[model samples]
Target: MWTDVTLKQILLITDGCSNVGTDPVYVAQTAREQGVTVSVIGILDDGALGEQGQREAENIAQAGGGMCRIVRTIDLSHTMQMVTQRTMQLTLQQVVNKELRQIMGEDSDALPPDVRTKVARMVESGTEEVDLQVALVVDVSASMTSKMPSVREAIRDLEFGLLARGGTHRLVVVTYPGPSGEDAQVLRFEGTSVADAVGALRAAGNTPTGPALFLAVRALRDLGESPATSSVRANPEDREEGRMRHYVV
Candidate 1:
């Protein structure tokens, strides 16, 4: 039931390797489904698209449905540093777009159709350049353990989906237990990298929603607050309690 009104503007930094345009495209498309934007930025600049890496950057940008800018850092050391710093900064900005009232707050009755879609798309177009964070919160109680593997499979598919898209789409996963006797433990913590996050989601626990919700919030908060933090967190101010629930068999 957790509905995210905030959308992220991603900045995809790339080296035009095996994944290249694929990652950005995947993020843009998937994020658009849930409201996120993606943009591309070429750093190492090694691709067949253009001279001096201009063409590669442009293609990456276009593929992500955003404007692409190429930066020329001195060498590997500087480039890595710049990429890390820039990615975090861009991720922060994306977080903002999701929750910011820059365009219009939740109170607005309705937005013009085309305009609303455009605004949403712009936010999603930047999914590639930044470090992508996808948090999957599942409900798993004793009654649900029989189906945990299916749920896990679904999430695993999501991971593959993000990886197939490439870039730094980090996945953070958690599961809430039902009220039955056995369900009451942390499935995953926020800010845990994709691999570790997935590893933590073992199937057995009660759905302690109150703590589970907060756990998810704390996980992301640990990663460093982002603009999307307000909209994405477990705040009564930003989200209604029912906005984060999901049922699976």
Candidate 2:
């Protein structure tokens, strides 16, 4: 069984549109139903993706309840970092709104916009010290071959960006169509950089993104059960004093 965690996301980076079995949007919707967010980054370089591809990217994100953005290869790293931070911010906002509804009455939706913003800011500041686990699911289909270099640089930049935020995080890299066709391979680097693994990916085979996402979710669930992550509580309680503070960001 999969363990419930504070945040579980599948960041899909692809260049071409899906041409496989199940629709990617449906897969993304299933992920959301299972408490996982799926964000898509469509890489557009030299006019690789057309109108249909862009629409598919947007539709997938909408179905998954996450953000989608299209960017050139040169901007991949910056966009990747932005997407991660944006997802965290949006999640924080949702947590704050839920807490507000619980603290205030159900009819307290009458609060002014500025007041709500202030409260959200307070909540974000309070939860800045929390840790995060991100699953990066990259599409290594044949079409994305030319964008591999940019993808590698992006992952490296994302790591530095996360570090600058002063939060502890574990980033697991999952690539689709591993040596064998349509297989999702989970790669981990000990005493080495994940960017290397990403850069080494060879683009081949079909884009079985639906199955890849299923694999990513499973990986995240397994990560949640690890001994290191097991000790961290999303909503911690003061056992001695019988007080509790619910924090989810």
Candidate 3:
């Protein structure tokens, strides 16, 4: 795995409950163990997500070392972008703290928390160049059909937001219980945009969230194990710096 990557995240977007396959919360814990941060967004339109669903979402996020939120379909895009940016900021702070320890040694503790935070943000802005890899996991269960259009729009917004931030990124889309009954359909875009691919998503079938997560984790791990990643990690210059990897569903 790419243990040296700066950040890893899994964003799960769903509207209803998980009724099939392995326990998603347990899978989230496993993902966290493997250095993947799992965050969840529960869409509450039409009152589809009940108390149980909310609890599950919260539990999964907690177990995966991330945050969980319940929001309307209309707010999905903004919420998703906020979560991504916040996670990245925190990861950067972690890297900054590590560097402080190396530089200040025992004297690092003398720095105030607010001062450290300010310096971390400044350092991250100037020095942290990231190679961001994201896996978008979306729930395509029957209950999510009506929200597909909004979901598609939200994805486009997310893409644009990332572009505006100015970084190198690779975003892949994965839908649970994919078209052919596979655990999930992994879609990679070439020259086309993510919105175009999202517009083609048809919601149906069961929400095998656990299996879908497993597939995403595997894909991200494969990316970390790729030859390109190996070459980057092997370079002495790159070895001292960190990159970001994420799985967002």
Candidate 4:
């Protein structure tokens, strides 16, 4: 079994449009090319977000090769977990589809009903067992002020839910437009709790979504190379071996 495969995801939690830096969609696409899934969760304001805001959110997720959802602050907690899991399944399915094409010269969608059903089941099962490394590219833009309290609580809830899962996991929280003039800052969550880092969050500054995403993606790439990671890509042989074992390609 390819148990060493650590599912990587960058979950962008934003409530409004990106008003600064490069276009987030392009940056997300770059992350996807490096095998990282970037999902987005847009927090609704007064139960509404502008059309442009909605389009940008959807575009970013699409470019990242992941999923996107717009939800109320109250639903953020549940939605975060849902998006995370669903995107993981999506990532696995993509991997499997490529394998099917390379090995069988057929795509999953073109497979017979019975074979497709089995593939779907296998992807679902992978979601439950694969280890996870998720980074939250949070927007502390001025508009997110009132939503901060609920956002903090939702993050804590997401952590608890992740801990309950069968596979091991780690969390990274990065906020955009840092207080002291940084584009993005990676906050360490000491002792499995996000108290200190998230507590210092100030909802001020432009929504530099693209720069923040680039920061988080680079951080994750470096992290995956660390010895602490049980990632299959730790070595060349394991990386090739991973493609074979992970999807039975």
Candidate 5:
């Protein structure tokens, strides 16, 4: 039910009770796996079990990969409200970062020469910015056949968004065909601007991610030494000194 809805921050409160095994941690992990940052509050002074409960709470927080605060309260209601408010504020901050990345596609040093050349005209004509060497590797096996349309739409939306930013981001797409007996075939995509890349992609293969990723890495490494890589370097000074920044995205 929660997958369809987007949440920024999720806070879970537990009254460090001895009976509460790892439920807090379990919920927090689930929330964060869906891109939610989780916070926890341990309610101390609940009863004779407060100390034990507190320790369990702290352990749960660590296990869940979140921060925890101990609350000493006469009335549990007020403590819960405070924790809720704090969680909301943290979640709001996450939303802001998401918006920033949506606008800029995470900052990179410079555009490679090849990428720069493609976007040079666009930039000269007033394009915003572009992401370099963006690869969308999809696992398209037989099981995913029914969901192809949704996957395609998601990819299309991403393509449009990247192009709309307008600098000179290049795209590479590859789909894996499933294993046949003991052999697998690989599909490789050429690096190009987002528009052409998406238009050329079709899903009719198995999901051989391991081999595909290896090829993608090799192709990216080869391109890293090209003029395109130089042009797209984050800073001209770095390039002048023969410095290259390799990014793994």
Candidate 6:
């Protein structure tokens, strides 16, 4: 039920700061380099997240080329939907702009008003028609136990809304701090249905968001979702210091 032109993403739903493992920001950047966008939603119903937690969420999204937000249990459903849709639109725009640059040497914004308007319409339509493959990296740490109900509801809501789009969607579920002492565990590796996985979710172990993200990327790769990594001339804007990926293959 999927298509060839699919957008791959990792949507991380967490409640607090990572207490162990690798740095999430670095992992997020690596994911972006590998053709996956990583978005984060910090749950605030339990208590306010610390500054470090807030910063990490923001940094991860920026590094991974996705979106980030902090929301309460009641607002999670809306936030999740917003983040996923907004990220998909943004990614599609970047792709469209990249193509425009190759053809006209200018981005959409630099085009004549009429031309820009047409390009915008195409991007909008593409956003609604393009397929999606999302790996939901959920936080199963003990602290998140009380929020599982809301989490489950949000997942269902997200799936319902996305499936209503013209394009097909494939969803995978992965939870961090595996019950058996691992960094992350894959409850649902295939797609769309997460009920079984949600029932299997257990609240235990310390948070390990970084390692969990790494595993999520690996899982997506295992499923052959990420685009093939090949060498290409770096875009001019991407030539800035710390942004270059010359001859990447």
Top candidate by TM-score:
4
| TM-score, one value per model | 0.37, 0.82, 0.79, 0.86, 0.33, 0.84
- lDDT per residue, candidate 1, 128-246, as tens digits? 32345544434443444443444445455445544543134444444555234432233444552343453444444433433443344444444446433221222122222222111
Q: Once superposed on the true structure, which residue ranges of model 2 sit more than 4 Å away at CA?
A: 1-5, 105-110, 228-249
Q: How close is candidate 2 to the true structure, as a TM-score?
A: 0.82
Residue lDDT tens for model 6, 22-110: 99999999999999999999887764367888888999999999998998889999998999989998887788778778867888789
Give the winner by lDDT. 4
Off by over 4 Å in 4: 47-49, 227-249
Residue-level lDDT for 17 in candidate 2: 75
* lDDT on C-alpha atoms for all candidate structures: 0.39, 0.72, 0.72, 0.81, 0.40, 0.79
Model 2 root mean square deviation, Cα atoms: 5.1
Tens-digit lDDT string for candidate 4 (110-130):
999987887886675566667
Worst 10 residues of 4 by lDDT: 229-238
lDDT of 6 at 44: 78
Worst 10 residues of 1 by lDDT: 240-249
Sort by TM-score, top down from the best: 4, 6, 2, 3, 1, 5
Q: What is the lDDT of candidate 4?
A: 0.81
* True-vs-predicted CA distance for residue 243, candidate 5, Å: 24
The deviation in Å at residue 167 for candidate 1 is 4.8
Candidate 3 deviation (Cα RMSD) = 6.8
